[model samples]
Target: MTGKRAFVTGVSKGLGAHLASCLAKDGWQVTGVGRRPRESAEVSAAVDYLQADLSSAEVIGGLVAKMDAVPDLVVHNAVTYPDRAAGRPELDTIETTMRVNALAPYELTLDLLAAKPDDQFCSVVVINSESVYHADADSAVYAASKAALRVLTGGLAAACRSTNAAVSTLMLGPLGDANKVEEIRRIAEKRGATPAEITRLFLRRSNPDLVIDDFIDFDACYLSLRYLAELGAVANGMLCRLDGGSAGTLV
Candidate 1:
């Protein structure tokens, strides 16, 4: 992965930020696009930050132009967490969700492929959610969008077969975040235990055959990226589920 170029979306924080940092550490030139401004100096130094909202087609087009040339890797990790308490989602909400989650990535991929030479190798990784399989109270639209993304990835695999570009989708489960850890930590403190203990208990309750314990942090997910990158270097299309053994059999 050394000296490879990667374009990552949603690098403002969380897994996106972590992915950017890990790729940079591996000696890859990373460019991260996010809606928010880059705040951390570490993240800022790890990748070139481009601030743009994915919801607008115009903004996405501008982003495409800025790339100059197609990158070796394109990671669609940016997402909008729906407001579950908003009751039945409005038409606008559903439209925005689809646009940001599925449409933007699809369009950006096409543009990148178009900008590249015929034999250039490119890899696309879409960070999807397990919610597509098990929808929660407020994630109906979100789940649908991810499902569409999965379908899109399949189509892209076929479309890019002769173009030397590989497409992959990673259906992830509950990823750990600072706020989630803090909340769990408070509960663990009340119960006279550590956060790691509570996290293990939670995972055991979630699934007994958990492959990786602890929250799905940057390090855990980074392995998936590496796998995809390696496969993309040779293969055309691949779908992987990384939900800590909760997805059962790979369908």
Candidate 2:
């Protein structure tokens, strides 16, 4: 990233913010897309911000021009996870999840690749998750959406073989960020699971003897993002598991 440009999605907060900062610190001219790109203080320091919602392709058309020169690194990191439904939900959560998690990233990357065909070491990384192989009480939409992304990564990588662009994917496990934990809990609770159920499985279950008072940390999220970014050259068109503990892996 010495003299390259990086574009990351979902940079309003969480892993996206950390990823943007890390890339800028590594000398990448970074641009971040988010719902509220204006007031992201962390993003402002390290990269330019665009208020683009992945949910709407109409908004993305205007934003694409800003990066027409095309970036060296593109991360389709923005995602939509579904809230748990106590009763069967009539709403098409899978449609929304699939569009945001899978289609938008695929479309965005294709546009970027078309403009930057001659660029060297261009990488498109999708942030996936362990949930792909594991089942949750109410995560059908989320799992299916990420599975779509996983398939896209493989197909895109094959397509990129003849070009300079490379495609890689990373799957995430649980992180240590409080906001992420809260968000997960909210989704879980919406599915009718109690807070105690969350604590027993996501928190103390992993540690066995630890305190339930623990919260997710930001550095772990940053480490996962940064690790994938750094591995772009060596890991072109490959899906690497970020979870060492088998969460993101099948075996």
Best by lDDT: 1
- lDDT by residue for model 2 (62-181), tens: 566777467877888888777665455446666778888988888887777777757466778888876777656677778878888888878888878868777888776655555666
Off by over 4 Å in 2: 40-44, 85-87, 180-234, 248-250
List, in order, the clash count of every candidate structure: 0, 6
> Residue 100 error for model 2, in Å?
0.7
lDDT: worst 10-residue window of model 2: 207-216
lDDT by residue (17-63, candidate 1, tens digit) is 88998898889899999888667433647698888899998998878
What TM-score does candidate 2 get on C-alpha atoms?
Answer: 0.79
RMSD (Cα, Å) for all candidates, in order, is 2.2, 5.4
lDDT of 1: 0.83
Worst 10 residues of 1 by lDDT: 37-46
TM-score of each: 0.91, 0.79
lDDT by candidate, in order shown? 0.83, 0.72
